[model samples]
Target: MLRYAATRILFLALGLLVASALIFATLRILPGDVAQMIAGTEGTPAQVERIRSDLGLDRPVAAQYLEWIGGVLTGDLGTSMLTRASVAGELAAKAQVTIPLGALSLVIALAFALPLGVVSAVRHRTRTGTAIGVVSQLLAAVPVVWAGLMFVVLFAVLLGWLPAQGFPRAGWQDPVGAIRALILPAVTIGIVEGAML
Candidate 1:
């Protein structure tokens, strides 16, 4: 058990290293200079060079990668180039919505899937079971983004039942509003996942 756990941890660390390296490499390869973007259209060449130097972008690629990975390992996500905000803080703020949406989606998926799956299994070969199976397959085949758009049209535009977009500025402080905002998204994700199940 100890050996297995250690092996898993080792592999997980290796995977992270490889993923991070690829991400860093990809960003480096992309067109457009980060310093130039930050400096904007009117920035002088001297300003761009200074911005690059300040960001340590003038260093060797390997040194930059090492510094970045080291900071990540130590729980410093570094500052965003555009926003100049803490990357970790930005991620944490987004997680407030993302985590809840995921949980609610799973809950809704399981709630519908479990009972419907059971009925479909028990009534195998019957018309009701066949209909349910067909519907599930159809739902599963629908693209999630398209489903979300259609749902927004039906529930938000036509029925005027929910807000079409954006999270509450107050976040969970406005519990009822938060949940209302999430309901359509959760249901859209849930329908697809439930169909798959």
Candidate 2:
């Protein structure tokens, strides 16, 4: 089991590396100049060129990739393209929503999914087992966004129990409100993920 786990982890790391590489390569190949876009329509050639140089867009793709890889290794995710804000800071702020939602969803999913899975497997020959299996399959087929939207429609739109969009501006400061705000989204992601699990 340990060996299997290690192998899985290694494969997951490999997949992440490949995916990051693909993202970088795709961004490099995209049309139009990012520097020009940033410099804007009224900007002259010299200004655009300056912006490009400042952004290190003048560097070779290989050099840029190496720099990016080094920054990522050192926990420097670079700056936001539009806001000029620290990418890491933005990610950290965003984590308030993602982290709690993910953690809660995982817990909710596991707490319910495990037992359902076990029962379904155990009673495979029984009518109840067949019903459970069908339900699980049906849930697994539903998309995450659809589930989230349904939660919003039911809880936020219809019942007005939770906010439909946007996370708390104060983040986790108000613990009660934060949890309540996240519950719908968490349940949305959790239910779909748990069912798929």
Candidate with top lDDT is: 1
TM-score of every model versus the real structure: 0.96, 0.86
Give a tens-digit lDDT track for model 2, residues 103-179: 99899899869999899999988998999888888988999898888878998999998887667677788787788
Alpha-carbon deviation at 85 in model 2, angstroms: 1.8
Colliding residue pairs in candidate 1:
none
Task: Write the residue-wise lDDT of candidate 1 on 117-170 in tens digits.
Answer: 999999999998999999999999999999999999999999999999768999
Model 2 bad stretches (over 4 Å): 1-19
Q: How accurate is candidate 1 locally (lDDT)?
A: 0.95
Q: RMSD in angstroms, all models?
A: 1.1, 2.8
Worst 10 residues of 2 by lDDT: 163-172
